[model samples]
Target: MTYRRAAIPALIGGLLLAALLWWAGSSADALRLPGSVGTLGPDAVAELQRWVAPWAYDPPSFLDAGVQGHGYVLLGDDGRDRYNGIYTAGLQIRYGAVFAAFVLGALLLIRRLPPVRGRTTAAFLALWAWGAAAGTLAAAVSAPWFIAAAGHGSHRFLPQLASVTAAGRQLPVAVSLVAAGATVLVARIAAEGASTPPRTEVPARAARLAATAGTAVIALSVVVLSYQPVAAALQAYSPDGGLLAEPGDLLRQWLLLGAWDAPAAGAVVDWLLHRASDVLLLAVVWWALSRLPGLLTRVTLPAMAAGAVGATVLGLLASQLLRIAVVQTGPQQGLLYSSAAIGNGIPAALTCGLLAGVVATAVLRLSLRGAPEPAA
Candidate 1:
């Protein structure tokens, strides 16, 4: 086999696998494993783990069931549905995508090789396929660990998300992820199977300028949307627009920013803005991780590892921010929802962050004309 073909994919697969293994450990409630401490009880801990636990995802039916109930139904007794809003992606959709990609990569690599009869080519493809699947599965399973460490959610699994705007609020973020993920998959696949197109790309200066402009646009839009309120009257909240005050004062009275001490409308605007901010910050975390190789040129591997740690840190910050922004900032109520939210968010954030870093390092190394070694 040509060295580039054999070595490049193996390296990328290794980096991807390492990231996945990190994610799986995170998913296992790395924060609250058997010895894990925190607000979550065994029951709550077990609740989120059911989704990402390793080898447990064998049956497609369980995933479908999880989606229908956790995905579509099941509001908690708290009158605010936490489960539906959290986890973000259903098990089958997220992990299934990973599994599919690995299987496809394996088949594509095998087919591209000079036609060899049966087992020899098959065995080689199987080894790489196994690597890809193992890594992707690890990341899927580890997703929860990063979420739990964030510490944002309630402790219960089936909490009610009875609020009206929440459904509207969550839709945009979910749509963004699905679209980005799909694009990444399709683009990478096309790049792999098709011949490398002629390298007539834009100059680095223009590309940097464009990236800067994109960041500025996203930032400005987020800020304006946060401050700007829609003129349409909001739907009457559950229990009849009880959001006339701060959330902590009364349970679920979360008038958001609109109903806050300010013009309830302004408060609502701020609340929405804050949600956008969390999403943007999560994006920042991802971008920062993607720059790991360039950022720490002398210590790329350690930098990748640090990217994982940083992701976990970012997830925790994001969780705290979400609690402050969305669900009422309060002292007295049960922390069930907060704990669960963190459990879900922290791991997922770390998962993405770590993946971004690994992928970044992989691409940088693979494309380098001649990478330098660290000094002795």
Candidate 2:
């Protein structure tokens, strides 16, 4: 009966989720400039700004409209068509990969701890709210981090925060609505079965370790997912920030593409270092969580909360140190980067990790309540 109730919402939610993810990917592509603007002339910046204006905002000025018209003329019909096709295709691929991951992760997590009560609906909604807040907060912090990492933008914090806040306010309604609906649908589906399945038990120590690792994965995913929007905000506000404009995957190319005979080798090393930072952070979080007890039970909530906060601080410090070691940079630059990271790291981690801890606990509590105790 519960399963029957969930089907309709789940189907609708799935469709909405697809649309939202695509829109997010499209926004990323649209905000990005055609090429590096480090050496762009004033006319080129004007043209590009006019071209990107429609996506950036609405109710374009007459002058902006005129500039866009000129841009189209410059590109010509054939070039314009080709660019449009590439943009559309890039968005499709970006969203497809992310949406695939979301679906797979959602299903795996749901199956592991299937929702077994109607109250799961409320739980899902709460999780969604927490996630939204977490993303917004990450943007607030990361906006400044973007500038600091670049080392050339305004060092002022208030403007950076305001830029991110404005971007958050401008998010499309469709995206928010669809995201909320999807969360409810996930909740409904997870709670469909009322029968208490047999609870699986592992060695106490092992279960704690697994739970710790899982929590870290959840927290880290939040951090990575927020990067897209934050990056977009940077592009919007500081289009001419040179290397700052093209971080992420482009960082490797800029650093090692020259002066190295084997570009591929450089890429491999770059990838390793990038991943190593993430792994290092993950390990730190795991260690932090391990210090807490009752990892698999309701008692785990406080532990998870505290551990997550600690993990964030430790992780940030560790990553900064690693960056200094790898880059072999002077103390001044290193301190500047570290300060930027800390500025964002504390609040972002606190908000994301705490809320994640709460949500994870809620899911676990529900799952445990539904499942039967293990037999001797």
Which candidate has the highest lDDT of all?
2
lDDT of 1 by residue, 1-376 (tens): 2334334443444345334433553556464455644566665555445433432322223223443222343233332223323333333334444444443343333223311332233223233323323333434443443233222223321122222112111111222233223323333443455443222222333323323332333333223322334211223222323333222221221221212122465477765554654565546544433332332314344344334334433433454556655564566433443443332232223333344445544544454425444331
Total clashing pairs for each candidate: 44, 2
Can you give the lDDT of residue 76 in candidate 1?
39
Which segments of model 2 are wrong by more than 4 Å? 1-11, 20-73, 117-181, 185-194, 202-204, 210-376
Cα-based TM-score, every candidate: 0.30, 0.35
Error of 2 at 79 (Å): 1.2
Every model: Cα RMSD to truth = 16.1, 16.0
lDDT of 2 by residue, 263-372 (tens): 25548876556556656665665664443323222244654454454454455446645755664356544333333322223344455556555654454455456555
